[model samples]
Target: MGLKPWQKALFPLRSVAAVVRLFEAELRQPEPDLVLLSLVLGFVEHFLAVNRVLPTNVPGLTFESRPGPDPQTRLYFPVAELSIVAALYARFTAQIRGAVDLSLYPRPDGCSSRELVRKVSDVIWNSLSRSYFKDRAHIQSLFSFITGEEGPPRVPPGTKLDSSGVAFAVVGACQVLGLPDVHLALSEDHAWVAFGAGGSQTAEVTWHGKGNEDRRGQPVQAGVAERSWLYLKGSYLRCTRHMEVAFMVCAINPSIDGHTDSLELLQLQQRLLWLLYDMGHLDRYPMALGNLADLEELEPTPGRPDPLTLYHQGIHSARTYYNNEHIYPYLYLAGFHCRNKNVKEALEAWADTATVIQE
Candidate 1:
């Protein structure tokens, strides 16, 4: 059944218009509009038929928004860079279709719109899933569900530690676990994770590292004389393969409970060492050495030996950081191993290390 002339004439252009309209609608939202547009545009370029122009109302071209970690990180394309890419793809793709029609499909242009879109989207998606927005949304959801009950109202940006500050709750857990070797590594540019076994694996818990920050000049804070944006440009955030190996090991260990029993502690520590090695950190002596050093530095609090032994200890410690989700893994480590006698001192130091999140 040969198609009617009018039907063929309208299909391709209508499809192009529909995709463009979708981009326009997405850009109006407060969230990462550009990131969403990039994904959608890429899809259109790679898969949409080019023979007929379709309107912007086509349902197939629309992508449903998938729930992800709050404020998820994807490829950090500058607004201008993204605008250019999306606009070019949209325009050129339609042009290709028009050209193909003129040539009677016997020989379409060498560069198909669909093929180019596929290539670009694939690269963007891979970089995004690994480098940013891995499992942040789920962590946020879990946190809200656990702690949103009646309390001294929780504020946004709770505790402010640049990237490496440990959540206060974890420090309290340290007191409970009696493991002096656990401590948070503070940095302004990146979030990092490092532990000596016995932590939670409900999601991807990885440490962030400090990549050098480029100078923007001057401290914007009122009291401080120095000011600069704590931004790292062209910095690639990555976890060594060992982190994954560690993640898997921690997931199966039975010693990761909150009881802090001696038998469990021994097993957890043994399992942790194996994970650290799997993460390729066996030769990276300093990180492990640092953990031990942190353990030794905890000042013994007279009364609060098992800081986490008390239920309130968790609340008090968590008070130090606004959003406590980032450090849940560390809390699991400290809570599972630390004993009551010396955990308080470590908890105090961890508290002092964190900066309260500012509005």
Candidate 2:
């Protein structure tokens, strides 16, 4: 059968446009219909299948092919899979919306948008896993659809962290910590923070922890052993080990030696480290304080009025500066101490940080 020239050209264009418009419209609404969203995604899948754009073995629930009396074709999703998608979508959207609404309520700790997205993804994954015991790939596709990811969920090579989640979390942490000017630099397997013109100042704050077992079946311990090292201006500062303390020293180094450039460097480093910790990279604390102890061992930079005196002065100045920040670091330090079995110090730190928070 021969088709009209205009019909062939316009049909595919209209089909693609419809799918795009459906998603665009759905996203603009505060509360979109989950069933409608699922239908739109299904429509896209079907369109791809009809046009032979998608490979035959693509992961996800397959639409049963039905031959019609006429030349026209259509796609049909399994009733069971569609039901699961709708249910999962409803649960995810409700929880996400609730978390966002609750963030408005007064509290010392606030939730970030990245956290909200994670919460939603977790809930959806859990719900789907519980309901659909098989077809992991199909479940992932459905998840990707609801989360607006291009394809199935994947952990990037050479990293355990979800790049999308980390990127979003870093941005959210910056906004929360009042460092709006800080920018994120992302690569295929890593992401970090950068500040200043041309990103002259940079910090790698992403977590790089080893999981339970390596390829050799060796037990991989977490914490400092699994901590990823950070670089500053192509120089290995070992800042990842004692991220917070490193930032403090850097921030106050200028006060010690009267160097404007070092002060700016430290300030940017401090902000980046704070965002990293707040974004749930908690295991770096072991290395963080350890790095602080090694600070005195560093060689004195040129033009310092008094090398020994300036080093001590910088340490003291950094401590005082951090102390004035309303006990934020103390709370984290308390957790670090507790994790390291310093119960007495943890208790004291917690008590002090709590008092500040209460006031």
In model 2, the clashing pairs are 241-287, 241-288, 242-287, 242-288
**lDDT score, candidate 2, position 335:** 56
**Candidate 1 structure quality by residue, lDDT tens digits, 94-172:** 3333323323212132322222222222222222222232222112111111112233456322211111212212221
lDDT of model 1 at position 107: 15
Q: CA lDDT, every prediction?
A: 0.28, 0.34
Error of 2 at 235 (Å): 18
| TM-score of every prediction relative to native | 0.21, 0.25
Error of 2 at 285 (Å): 34
* lDDT over C-alpha atoms for residue 112 of model 2: 27
Off by over 4 Å in 1: 1-237, 255-338, 356-359
Candidate 2's residue-wise lDDT over 9-118, tens digit each? Answer: 32222233333343334334433232333333433332332223434654454544445335795533222243444454454345444444434433243322333333
